[model samples]
Target: MKKTAYITGGSKGIGLGIAEALLKEGVSVAITARTQNDLVETEKHLKTIGDAEVLIIKSDVRNLADEEKAIQQVVDKWGGLDFCIANAGVGRFSPIDEMSAEDWNSVIDINLTGVFNTVKAAIPALKKSKGYIFTISSLAGTNFFENGAAYNASKFGVVGFSQAIMLDLRPYDIKVTTIMPGSVATYFNGHTPTDADAWKIQPEDIGQMVVDLIRMNPRTLPSKVEVRPSVPPSARK
Candidate 1:
């Protein structure tokens, strides 16, 4: 039987990277996003990844109902889930004084509470399948910086929430890992990926890690992963 994965924000960047990687492993992937355009393009590229099925789901992770709908569609289509990657998030950089209520709430809603909704929605299915959960955090989860108040708060929340749930879910054999990645060359932060960004981590690099994590011995779990570009920006210059 083929493994199955549900990836929120799978239309682009890190989520898309993981979806492609899992597809090549023969895993059926259900990818969800709020935008239909991106999902359509991503599903097309995903089909070229390998001979696995791609389920396109138009969803907003911030909404619990939408998340539950995505999970149910996956279960109805593929039987059950083997993994859930909560990768939907956004970042806004500004000093605390300059940040708007909308900025803070949007970030926290999608980045932190969004994961809460995704995990809760997937729990029943995950327990049934003895599944894995991957939460895409950031280096900011542990590190702080100026103009990063909202982004930092959300990511920090992700690390804490994921670990707590890890403890709660072990008895059911559901593995949870929060992935904190440093500087990646992607459309994240509104920056277009380019050749000059080669020094940074690639989305595919993160994808490979997800595949490796799920392949680990069922007896062991590396619940937290912090990945960074081996070459620092100063060194890259």
Candidate 2:
């Protein structure tokens, strides 16, 4: 049977790349974003890639109800979900003293709580299918920097949460993995990707990794993975 996957924040960046990869592998994918226009455009783009079914859901990960509804829609259309990627996230960079309460809350709500909501909503279906869960974290989840208070906290929470859930879900044969990637070339944090980004890890690289993980033998589980570009700009002469 063909597998079905759902990705949060799937309109662009890493989410879009994962959707494309899965579609190529004949896995029906449902992508969710907060904007209907972006979702519609993504659906059109994904359709051109392969014949696999693509569903675009307009949802905000911060809302548990929205996530629950999105999961139901995918289940209704695809019968069962084999994979769920909690890739929805945001970055708010500022020193604690300089950060606004609103900015801090927005980062935590979307990056950390959002993962909780997505996984919570998808748990039942995944348990039934003995499926997989992928949570996107970052190197910053472990390494802190100046002006990264809010972003660091949220990502750190994600790492911890993902690990704990991995253990919790394992009893049901649900696989959970946390992918921590460094410096991907994506339109994240208001930065535009350019030719200069050629040295960085591409979003599709992460997508391909997901494909490989899913294809691995059921007896082996790589619970945590950290990915980095073989060479960074700083290493260049």
By lDDT, the best candidate is 2
lDDT of 1 by residue, 1-237 (tens): 289999999998999889988998999999999999999988888888788899999989889999999899999998999999999999999999999999999999999999999999999999999999999999999999999999999999999999999999999999999999999988987999989899899999999999998888888888999999998778755
Candidates in order have lDDT scores of: 0.94, 0.95
Write candidate 2's Cα lDDT for 1-237 as tens digits.
299999999999999989999999999999999999999988889999877899999999999999999999999998999999999999989888999999999999999999999999999999999999999999989988999999999999999999999999999999999999999999999999999999899989999999999999989999889999998978878
Stretches of model 1 off by over 4 angstroms after superposition? none
Count clashing residue pairs per candidate. 0, 0
Q: What lDDT, from 0 to 1, does candidate 1 have?
A: 0.94
Residue 207 of model 2: what lDDT? Answer: 96
Clashing pairs in 1: none
